[model samples]
Target: MSWRFVSLPPQDGYHMVTSFVSVADYVSRGGRNTLLVFSVKEPFVNVGVHQEVWLEVDLDYTSKAGIPVVRRDLGGGTVVITRGEHDYFVVVNQDEAPSDPKALYAKYLSPVVEVLRDYGLNAQLKDQDIVVNGKKISGNGAMTHGKAVVLAGNILMKLDVDLMSKCIRVPTEKFRDKMAKDMSEWLTSLERELGYVPPREELDKKLKASFERNLGIKFEDSSLTSEEIEEWERLAREKMEEEWIYYKDRRHPELRTERCVKISSSVAICHVDYKARKLLRITAKFLGGKLAEVSISGDFFVMSPKGFIELLEERLTNLSPEDIPKEIDRVFEEKKPTIFGFTADDLKKAFLEIVNKPEVREVI
Candidate 1:
């Protein structure tokens, strides 16, 4: 299908973010698939949908620096968007995009990989990251927006590593130094590798052509619909309020303890401790509200298949909140993996304590 293509001039934080959201809402209401490309002209800190402002960022630093901190309606880690990064949002109908995570990332990120490779960088998609060699060059994030799947990512042309590290809250200046060093090694930009950043006009043209050739679709240059503009205005107004910037902190003041951090409506990182006959600690990474990565530790004994803990962790993957205790009990009954000290009730309570909380506001 022919997609509507709108390449915006470098915009401020407000328009850059809300444009994709408005377009995604447009698609949800039966508008055409869109490929919106733009860059941020002003420096700003974009907090992930689920990131805690106090835990993750240095508000005093950002506020003093005149860099507005805004929470985007998408999953991923906090990102520092400034003058040099170019971003693209693929807002497509759910039916048009692949539902499988791997398939979706490969399909959407391949164009960027191709563009990077053409620019003499060995760019490839390593899981969710667009990497050059082993270092990440682009950080991509995705989530469903109504009837659309919104995949957003950016190419770092000239990253200010020092500024980024300083914007994040750390316990000490010593730790911040360590973080800056690590960030420099972990992330790369065109300027760092190529001795110069590519011209914006050149990169933009190349990206448009690369996307078309890679995705087997043609783009017809278009503008946002009146409905999308109206929605953008409303979203902009809402996003500008302090509540939206610190939404997570405002809603769940208790999670100030950093027990759970939601990346999106369906994805979260959670932790909880349950006391039974022993101190049971559970750290879980949830995907689609199901336990994706589960780590159980602290004073527990397991009767073994040699790898009973591993097997149990694997089994917990993709199990919903209601199924956790039932599965634990089933495992004990059928597999006899006999985890001593903590009963399924302890496990259930721990799971409920973390998952059933006021975290990400339910999208539905």
Candidate 2:
């Protein structure tokens, strides 16, 4: 059967990528082999299945940084992606790929591993992760959409270690410094390792060659059909909405902390706590578009909790209501954690409701 290879414009957020996945799901339901490749404009923190955004990120810090937080339907550790990273999503009917999930990952990733080797990166597939020098460089996840299985991952061609460390919330006292160093040692970028950046087109070509060689298939370059494009736009809009981006589900508030920020919006509530040193609890309520409440909690150590809260409050006062989510996302992006399963949007909604309640609105 002929395979369709469609390259899409760079999508900046999880919602857009997931929208494309919806299109792939539709195509795969019709028994087509679909490969979608796209890039993103900004960096975003993506959580895996069975992970909570609050548990994995430092909301207090992230809300101030303007980073975007997202939760993927697939399962894996949380990952940070910026413009320097390249991502791929492949959707194939079950009959088109191996039935066994493990086998399917191997079959699909063989090409990526080969391509990395050709670039002299010494890339190898270990278990379900793609490793370079025994450190994970690429991680892939698979999910079933209709009758098709979708495989998606990113190649960290170049990443900002300091920024990544600052973007995620981690547990150790020196976690930020340690992660910056560890990531530098564990991950390699084509630009850093080769001392020059490869053109995007060239990289795509190399990946295509590797895919053809390993999968024994020919790919025909194509564009999305009108039907697919229409569907994509519709889905993208829905994904970007508050309902999908935040408050998709509700659960008991698990973690809590207290933080303060100095912003025009007034004393916005800020809460943050840690687990294993990573962000575990994050709640921020805005008062008059300012932070009114900030709480942090979890099974993590925090020396001078009062000091941390005061610092956050000062920062919150400086932030605008619109900046809240970005700030929260930045904290999570810098601080990496195991993640519990809640999403940033989930916490955001809770905080928003708590802080932004209408003058006439009342909590039950």
Candidate 3:
């Protein structure tokens, strides 16, 4: 199907996020047209839908700097965006895209990978992000809102590591310093990697061409429909309210404490204490590239047969780290179990934290 490419003028934080929801709404109601929106917005910080605003952002600094802090309806951590950064939103019917989270990310981001490769970067989709030389160049996520499937993220042109670190409220100055240093080493931008950043118009042309080639679909330039504009305005107003910006879902800290240690090349152990609706603590040992054992303990309420957590833990054993998310999905689907305050994604995220332990890669 042909897609509509909408290049919106630079907007505020509220409009930038609301546009995606509005487009999703438009597509959900028999609108055959898919959409690709490029959001050029002012500097601001946007937290994940599930994250705590107080824990992630410095409200005083943002308020003083006139930088808005908004929450997006997506999972992941906070991100800072500004004029030089390029944020793209791909809106299509859920059926039009792959259903698997990993597959869906690759399907939408393959074109982006191609674009980066053309610029002489050895870019690949690692986990959920596009990375070059083991450093992230693009970050993306996918979500299903009703019938519309949205994959959105930013292509880094340049990043202010110091500013980003300053805006976040970490537990200590030492931790904040470490975070800033890590970000400088772990994040890459077009200008930093290539020594020059292409103009927005040039990047747009290359991106459009890549999408057309990779997806085998053509796009026509278009403006927002009356319906879409109405929806955008309504969503903007609603999302801009203080209630939504300061929203909190977890009854406790999302990730309270996490630690991982490597014993040998083929053996490692990890412990993660996290909270969603309640609280969960995971202790896992990995051996020979598989989960040798796992334990789940917390204050979470599970409405299932006794020992359901044991069943879940047993199922997780002997599985490859990369396959945990799929296994969790299967267990939930087949068991039809109800885990209060936490969804399958939350479980998957917590489990991946163990898989992504630093020691897991040091051996390789």
| Clash count for each candidate, listed in order shown | 1, 70, 0
Query: In candidate 1, which residue pairs clash?
Result: 50-262
Model 3 poorest 10 in a row by lDDT: 249-258
Q: How close is every model to the real structure, measured as TM-score?
A: 0.73, 0.67, 0.72
lDDT of 3: 0.77
Model 1: how far residue 130 lies from native, Å: 0.4
Error (Å) of candidate 3 at residue 306 is 27
Q: 85-137 in candidate 1: lDDT tens per residue?
A: 88889999988888766688899889889999999998889866799988999
Q: Quick one: best TM-score, which candidate?
A: 1
Q: After superposition, how far is residue 36 of candidate 2 from its true place, in Å?
A: 1.3
Model 2, position 33, has a per-residue lDDT of 80
For residues 1-364, what per-residue lDDT tens digits would candidate 2 score against the true structure? 5777778777867554575467565766594586677788777776653344556666666678887777655655567778787778878876676755567779999888887888888788876569887877686767666666778886777768877787777776497788889988887777776787777777788888778788878889988777777777777666556454333122313223244333343433344433222344555555554444444333221211123333443445446666767776665554432232334555455445444444302211
Instruction: List, residue by residue over 122-144, the lDDT tens digit for candidate 3.
Output: 99998668999999999876666
Roughly what TM-score does model 1 have, to 2 decimal places? 0.73
- Cα RMSD for candidate 2? 12.9
